[model samples]
Target: MSEYIKVAVDAMGGDYAPQEPVKGVVEALREKPELYVYLVGQEDVLKKELDKYTYPEERLEVVHASEIIETGEPPVHAIQKKKDSSLVKALRMVRSKEASAFVSCGSTGAVLVGGQVLVGKSKGVERAPLAPLIPTATGVSLLIDCGANVDARSSHLVQFARMGSIYMEYVMGVKNPKVGLVNIGAEEEKGNALVKETYPLLKECKDINFIGNVEARDIPKGVCDVVVCEAFVGNVILKLYEGVGATLISKVKAGMMSTLRSKIGALLVKPALKETLKSFDASEYGGAPLLGLKGLVVKAHGSSKANEIKNSLIQCITFSKEDICGKIQENMKQDNKGDN
Candidate 1:
């Protein structure tokens, strides 16, 4: 028997709802035999989808949740009012220790609100930031505060750097990951008030491997392993990254089929090109994790498909095995003690 890693999934969340999420859970369970998924959603719909899959019945279970939190609803209001929502119930499972992690491809606002309100934060953690791993030329880099905490404070960025470092070192197996404050230029005195103020803090802090300012252009080159910034900047970087990647991929495909000669060339290079492009796909990296939380909560894209969901679920296994939350708490405790 394989070691069990219970992960609660929001089967009713995301653009495709029960179909994609349910398919994802089955694919994840099929790939990872040790994973036992709690598919939280309306049982009838989820059952219909799950019926299509051939897997060990004991590994996949559906926990009924009646309410569905819409994408447009206020996050706070949705999280509060919809106690029986698929999002809320899945989060509750994490809070209650029934599951090791919660994965949702739901409303970003609800996921952020629910992660903090439901899962709670680790002690000594003032604010938790959403950190997502982005593909880079060297490998992958963690972008902190990607879509969470838009008006984050300098202290928050510092914590993001520290938490990001811990995560990269332990979970991602990057030794002493270099931390960089996203800036307009490579200079120390550049950027807005937030970056200027956060720069020195990251520089002076002994917790992380601060590598000074990292311009946006250098991010894709993997100039730093952890890119720290407020959500406004981080979100822009994330969106732009996605937009550029998508456009490039689309253009490449279009160009490949433009002419008979190119089409023949495309056939010759298709396999190699496909493998190279697959590495850059954001879905392959899993979801954005809201760090500093008591229980692991990963928020996937609203339009996440089975591949992204499967990767997210699989990543949770590594997170649990590495005791990421425990390491964050321990590091935060040490930082707090030093401050006192």
Candidate 2:
């Protein structure tokens, strides 16, 4: 048998819990022969869910986790207390190098806290960032610091740009990905103090292709491959992006079904429209990755279904194969040496 990429999955972390997670794991194992999974969750629940699918038994194993961390609980307290929870166990697997990555649809706070505290950060990494790929008109653009480090400094934004660049270029197959600082205007003097400070630093960086300020409106037009911002601004952009996309899709469907003539037109356009809509679905791109960590940690949507979970697991394969953490570590080391 070929070498396998083992992934530790938090089977009880999402809204669908063991059912969707189990189904997704089984689907991934069936689809990728060289994959191994440690499905961490309540054993009985996982086993019952596993009974519904047919997958290679050798490739999938059940690891027991007795507790669960709820979304409402404080992250630091939960991570310290829920040592036997599925999320924590999966993180431990990555930390110990037993698994190439950890995937969760659990509490965002707990995932972020546990990832940094347990899995630790790569050497010379200042702050870990949650970066997710957002759908754009031309393709997907990577949004870095989407939910981590809300009070990030200028240096952190620079690192986010560089790391986002590496991810887009290597993992997403975009060559010489253009990096842009999120701002209100096209001119360099337009954004707030943070952007003002970070802009010149990004321009000075020789490693990444730094583009000028990118307005929020221009993001959907694929003006840049990597979008860099502090978490506060990035989160607002992401949520607004999602809300607008959903509203537009809903309005389009409603308009199509409003009248008899439109219904006929909808029938003719449904296939192509569905394909286009599917490409824009955030779930199609998997989960946000907490980059600059010692091990890979993917935070899937809490409402993730079988398809999103499967994509999340599959994305880990590319991340591990490309040795993203190693590359990030080397890059950070180089940056630290330059500073010294």
How many clashing residue pairs appear in each of the predictions shown?
A: 0, 0
RMSD of each: 1.9, 1.6
The CA root-mean-square deviation of candidate 2, after full C-alpha superposition on the true structure, stands at: 1.6
Worst ten in a row by lDDT for model 2: 331-340
lDDT of each: 0.91, 0.90
Query: How well is each residue in 256-338 modelled by candidate 1, as lDDT tens digits?
Result: 99999999999999999889988887888989899999989999999899889999998899898889999999988877343
The 10 consecutive residues of candidate 1 with the worst lDDT sum are: 331-340
The lDDT of model 2 is: 0.90
Off by over 4 Å in 2: 336-340
lDDT of 2 by residue, 60-155 (tens): 989999999888789999999999999999999999999989999989999999999999999888999999899999989999998755889999
Q: Which candidate tops TM-score?
A: 2
Model 2 clash pairs are none
The list of candidate 1 runs beyond 4 A from truth reads: 1-3, 336-340
Instruction: Measure candidate 1: CA RMSD.
Output: 1.9
Model 1: residue 275 alpha-carbon error in angstroms: 1.4
After the best TM-score superposition of candidate 1, give how far the Cα of residue 223 lies from its true spot, in angstroms: 1.5
